[model samples]
Target: MSYSWSTEEYSNHYSTDFDTIEECIKEAKDMGCKAGTTIWIGKVEEVDIRRVNLTSILEDLHNAVYDDVGEFAEDWYIEDIDSKEAYEKCENAINDLVVKYIEENGMKPTFAKVVDAELYVIK
Candidate 1:
């Protein structure tokens, strides 16, 4: 059967004939669909999307890294630094870690931004 797909935002459209339903569905997803926009599909039976709680995962990772850094800072043998200096250093380290994660995952979360020497992405 033939299938057609289009997006409402950019009005991007595509149509093609496929031998199987799976093929048609795959092609529809591959076609450009603007983020956070609905896609109109012709003759689509069902759709399945894998979901993950990214915020929870990120929070856990951030906390773990922050705790590790804090512990390292507190150890006198690691560095002879006072509380204020250690706090500032840990903050910078956390920002760098978050920024690197964002880049590696190709995530464009709204909160992610760069200012001066620090890369901030929430927290």
Candidate 2:
């Protein structure tokens, strides 16, 4: 796998992919990255999209439902609803919401996971 390098002074900047860490280090020095500057080396890996966590969404929905219904009943509380059923019902809605949001506004900013990552200080 190709390797790339970045430093604290240029966190947003990465060197071109090289066959070796030794090449990355040489390029970092050539670019005048100072001694003691922290450097990171790694290969970029794609982020996997998976199911979204629904607990927080369920809790929020529960609180909202509780707030509206509790106004008319003294005994109403958040735990009156079954969480598993609630989660099951809202799963598609939440997923659809996320998909809609991504379609309208584009996917949220994501960073690649650096595999076989290493850190060093400029010498």
Residue 111 of model 1, lDDT score? 27
Provide the overall lDDT of each model, using Cα atoms, as 2-decimal numbers: 0.45, 0.71
Q: Where is model 1 more than 4 Å wrong at Cα?
A: 1-82, 110-123
lDDT of 1 by residue, 1-123 (tens): 344444432333434445544564466556643345454444422222222334455466666766878755343332333576665666566667776776689873432211112111111
Instruction: Tell me the deviation in Å of residue 18 in model 1.
Output: 40
Model 2: CA > 4 A from native: 7-23, 33-38, 47-51, 71-100, 108-110, 119-123
**lDDT value for candidate 2?**
0.71
| Backbone clash count, each prediction separately | 0, 0
Estimated TM-score for each candidate: 0.24, 0.49
**Model 2 lDDT tens row, 18-68:** 888888888988888888777888886656443666766556766777688
Poorest 10 consecutive residues of model 1 by lDDT? 114-123
